[model samples]
Target chain A: MTQPAISPALPADWRDFFALTKPRVMSLVIFTGLCGLLAAPGSLHPVLAFTAILCIAVGAGGAAALNQWWEADLDAGMKRTAQRPLPAGRMDRESARDFGFGLSGAAVAIMGLAIGWLPAAILALSIFYYSWIYTVWLKPRTPQNIVIGGGAGAFPPLIGWVAVTGDITLMPVLLFLIIFMWTPPHFWALALFVKTDYAKVGIPMMPVVAGEKSTRRQILAYTVLLVPLSVVPWFIGGTGMIYGVSALVLGGVFIVLSTEVGLRSSVPDDAMKPEKRLFAFSILYLFILFAMLVADRFATIYGWQA
Target chain B: MIDDPRTHDLELFRARQKSRNRVLGSILGALAVLFFAISIVKISNQSHKKAEAAAAMAGQH
Candidate 1:
């Protein structure tokens, strides 16, 4: 077999493969998936739940690896991602590609065999959506890339719900919608701060393609949508008054920050205070919303009415 | 297809490392699954015994 000559310039090892998995992102995905599994009404075998979480982690890792592999050239140009495994020449591109495919295939197969078909199917879709559809196609083509592509991240809770109940319900779909609406504000804030890096790399992120004013306007729009969507689960009776109050309070704060970001005009070249504030608060918003979901789940489980 | 000796040697090194890592990963994965299974069985058994004792006491009463 005639293998291509290994690039002597880039000597990579196993650690590079691990780094390509984007462990930080995988942590959030796994946490939300676990929360969904735990919150669902149906019972799942403990071992099965563990397997489901593991599969979600593996699938997320695989997708992240493939994203790194596909975006290696662009990543090399971006200061934020210049140190990634592929761009840093710590791993051969082909190796990363193979590892991603292997991990993704194993994760989907294990999910289907051990858990259920619906969750496995959703997992498979998420992997492909991120790896190919989002990374390969949408990323380079449009500024609304993150908007459509956010579905990949939003699937975890739904996958978790399906893992437990073997069906998709309105509640999980609402959970999906909440994240979907939240993604634009969260990511666009980061994009606004890193617009120059994206512009230099020729990646058409919202801030780069649409300009900061338009991006901020879009962020406000999404935040407005998100605030209402956040309270939907409570209104629908999937969650309790506690989550309702949390959603309203958190969503109110999110709107204030987003409005500030929209109204601000004199931000310094190197200083992105509004963007930074939005990004920091966005993490808190998602965490509190999901935490409320889990709290409500426990309340119901313990027979606490309200 | 210029066969550089250094490149060939590097390829050989990578192939060896890949195989070693695969073997190690598989062993660790299998061991983890076995350990979890054993612990689950033990816990379930203990719970079952407790339930059985409670039922017996109830019958006596």
Candidate 2:
């Protein structure tokens, strides 16, 4: 008689646990959080600043893990997410959930004890925003999920700023708004291309629910709003002309590219090059824009106002 | 018998568990060091503030 083959019940790899944190997404969170710390009015001890950014990153990771835990079924349905640890059956949902809660609680406690209460409170709220508000409530139900969901990513900068200044200010709020507004156009461009995956999984992403035409137009609309909003920091003397000019140049390019995506009709099987271009440039745009904010601060210290 | 696949699988699992434990151990150590540093900084900052307040009071007198 032939022996029946059995697969070894192996434990999940350490890398799979790491992957649950969505490290790629965490990079942007860390960058914005650090920029917020850098751009704030007062100074923080370097160790404390590192701790603040670390808390933000860990909190975001916890939230991402929770998101994956809740969406495992939906993730398994979509090609883009089918390979995730939970979706792929490499990690158990219970482990993911435990890891999420542990990281989140540790991060919040450290933030409060090491930095201050306000930033810690905001850190906890951002985790709640992403895990409960965006993931559990909004995403499955609303086509406008990304709009409201953008708030989760916006808090890092605000938290970082508060860690330094220990008080809320207009500039950090503007930083928050820039991310909030930039999110819709940035996400929808990717949605325009991979909308089929979302549709298959019933996620109600704008492109999947609103159709490409409406999605494109809205992407352009948000870009138009974002350009002016980004330039506001300079207008109000919150930032120098370095950031101002960079924002203008970057926003101009964003508008031109978004206009292309906004104005054109995509063919059923086209490469979606414009949407792809906008998506790539949008990432570059925010990185450069925030970098300019820091650069402007550096320049002002060296006596270069212009 | 010396080359059984189940033994290899068990060995691999043990190795992964060991690696994860090491990482967790390292993180806990780092957290202890971090908390110590934070406590020191907070104490120093409080003392600095108290000294400034005392100076201001003396100036007022």
The global C-alpha lDDT for each of the candidates, from Candidate 1 onward, is: 0.86, 0.92
The stretch of ten residues in a row with the least summed lDDT in candidate 1 chain A is A2-11
Question: lDDT (0-100) at residue A173 of candidate 1?
Answer: 94
Cα lDDT of model 1 by residue, A1-306, tens digit: 754565444345666777888999998899889888888888776777888898999999999988988889999998899999888877788988998998899889888977778899999999999999999999899999999888899989889988999988899999999999999999999888878898898878988777888999999999999999989988989888878889999999999999999777545655888789999999989988898888988887787955
lDDT of 2 by residue, A83-198 (tens): 99998999888999999999999899999989999999999999999999999999999999999999998999999999999999899999999999999999999999898899
Q: How close is every model to the real structure, measured as TM-score?
A: 0.85, 0.95
Misplaced by over 4 Å in model 2 are A1-9
Model 1 DockQ class: incorrect
Give the TM-score of candidate 2 (chain A).
0.96
Q: What is the DockQ (computed on Cα atoms) for candidate 2?
A: 0.36
Q: Name the candidate that leads on DockQ.
A: 2
Runs in model 1 deviating more than 4 A are A1-11, A268-270, B1-23, B26-28, B31-61
What is every candidate's C-alpha DockQ against the true complex, given to 2 decimals?
0.11, 0.36
Clash pairs (backbone) in predicted model 1: A12-A90
